[model samples]
Target: MMSRRQIALAAFISPLLLSTSASFGADIYPSRPIKIIVPIAAGGANDATARALALDLQKKLGVPVIIDNRPGGNFVIGTGAAASAPPDGYTLGWALSAALSLNPLLYDSLPYKPNDVEYIAAISKSYQVIAVPGNAKANTLKEWIAEVKKSDGPAAIGVSSFGGTVHLMAEDLGDRAGFRVEPVVFRGEAPASVDLAAGQLPAMSGILANLLEYHRVGRVKILAISSESRLPLIPDVPTFIELGYPISAVYWNGVFAPKGTPKSIVARLSEAIREIVETPEFRARLAAIPDVNYINGSSDVMKALVKADQDYYGRIITKRKISLKN
Candidate 1:
């Protein structure tokens, strides 16, 4: 029903409008608030990291940032929520080593697959540690292993969660150290740490950041840490490499978005986080914690790192024949 002149104008403007729409969509990503999903309960390391990142991101990106804790199903609950979110710039997820690298290999089924999410940037890397009660008779890793040998049964080694990074680290370190450790799974690190500190549990293994406070308070004794080099925060503590075990394995935390999100959006998000991580304030905060390893890069680099890490963990799981039953 349009006249000739009106029809001509509409057709010309439609192409220009389409081009502008695409440009605006990509350029002004995250125009509103962004949500970051943490697949662990609040108060845990993962949750804390997410909150810290959210604070900085909100300030730099000039938009409100919100954190949603979805802790359950061994991290599957919150992770699944992230995987299923719309592939826009709005919903971001925290990818832990457990949910991203270990889950697909350790479990028979999962609510989401590795392909469901895309990596944005690396937040922090941490190594695991083996600790015992402060009052334990054995003071060193060697003495502890010798004492376990003299015992009738294997002493339980508490891991924060089943099939988590620490669970695998404990088992793997035990193998390398020529000892038998029966892993005891806990719902989270705080409870296991508390019980270990109170002497209810004999031994516990977890990321150094989680146990360093307990060590500082004399609630627990950190005998050995699993890292290639000694952490600067605890120069007195020896690493697995230093103890002749060469059992250094680390856990990484990164940011993620649902798959199929625009590369422009992902790149913007990655740059924002990378800037935050490089700031002196960020490094200072990490230094306050124990043995935090910082890794930063572009979105493409992070993606490549994820693929390589996935394969590495997958190989380890296969070689160890690690199953959920263990």
Candidate 2:
């Protein structure tokens, strides 16, 4: 019963209507809950940061943001899960520089590839610190280096993992200061702190946030930090650079989604995360943990950061002949 002109107009408008509907559909992202996979246990600065972000993100996105902790294998298990997830923007990964940069350099094979995930945004960077037992004789970096140099054999220093940021810094310290360094690997920083507090371990290298409490309570003494300049959290501690050492090792945390995720979703999440990171509330939260302030970098900035860490650490690894292989 329709005229030819009417049929033609209907055909023309139907496609445009469908296209507009699809565009609207694409815009309705995160209608359901989103899960962020954290590659560590449910404690410490990394977990706390992820949980805080999820809380704020839930309020911002109008949907639940859940954290899935998959801690083990130096972040391989969780990172692999995130990398293999569907590119629908529902699953994301909370990662550190170790998983993205150092793992590739240290290992011959990895469960996840660098290209497996797309960088979303950087959250924060934590500087490493060298701490000794609370009752250790050496109270300063100058004295500590002399003490280690005089030790009979390689001094044992606790580390979270071989080739980790702290491990590399410890190795560099030994190489420059004329002492044989032997690393005692632990599952994480907590156990290392335990050993350090009990006087079982001579010294350990860990993030400032984790060691701040121990240092405050007189359980351990932080000799030197790895930041370029001194941090306000512990003003008395001098940086390795200030202590006449060229060691500056800091690790960062960021968010990422599996590759092939829609740019729209990436942009949306990046904007939300970056906004949350810049707020005073969030800044205060991180400051409480005493982490080096929030880093405001989206995808491109994250990419550059990863690459810079890779390049710098790669040189150190190659120069020192560091290897995780047994």
Candidate 3:
């Protein structure tokens, strides 16, 4: 119904109009539910943190936020799934230290690389502690090291997972103290804490939260914490640094999106998370989880933290020649 010149102009304008519409669509992110893939089993500390964040994020974004637990493969399964997802900002991930730093250092190949997912914002960090059975002879970390040195064989230490902060720190401790550590991998820290409490396990390093109750009741003796200084909850428990060990088992959990996610969306989400984490209500909720501290780190901060972890753990893994593949 139009002239040739008019038809040509109409075609040119249609593409621009569609492009503008697409941009508008992106601006209204979370028009639907946003799913955050948590790379750990439900009911764990990471899962709890993810759920807490999701609930607040849902409220802030005016949309439903869901958590998808895709546990196993040392976070590869869920993290790979997140990496392969469409970069539309609807699908994201809750990533921990192993996914971002430790896995790459330990594995020769992975379904997802460090660059596969973009770090959005860091949510929280959990600290670890070295503990032994309540009735163990060694009371101090130095005494424990001495006892291990006297052992005829490798000392058995329970670890929640391989290629994790706990495993590497325990290995580093043994490496420095001139003893071999036999890491008995458990499904999670809960079961390992149970064994340690029952004296079925000789010693173990676990998150301070998992061991706090046990330590309080005398089921386990927390030798040292990974914090820079003593925690108010357990002020008497000294830090590894205080004991002359350069090991720290602190690990962070953060939000991550696919690599190609739009920068605007990344910034928006990061800002929202930082705002939520700084709230008094959120801080109170976080405090309920022992040993967990709210960091509220932005994307740049997360990148730096990830890099620092990679550099620190890389040296330890390379020096020890540790391979999770084995």
TM-score of each: 0.90, 0.91, 0.97
In lDDT terms, which candidate is top? 3
Model-by-model lDDT, in order? 0.82, 0.88, 0.89
Candidate that beats the other on lDDT, 1 or 3, i.e. the better one = 3
TM-score of 2: 0.91
- Tell me which residue pairs clash in candidate 3: none
Which window of 10 residues has the lowest lDDT sum in candidate 1?
Answer: 317-326
What shift in Å separates residue 301 of candidate 3 from its native position after superposition?
Answer: 1.1
Per-residue lDDT of 116 in model 3: 85
Better of 1 and 2 by lDDT: 2
Per-residue lDDT of model 1, residues 18-50, tens digit only: 999989877877689999889887886667677
lDDT (Cα) of model 2: 0.88
Clashes of 2: 0
Which order, best to worst by lDDT?
3, 2, 1
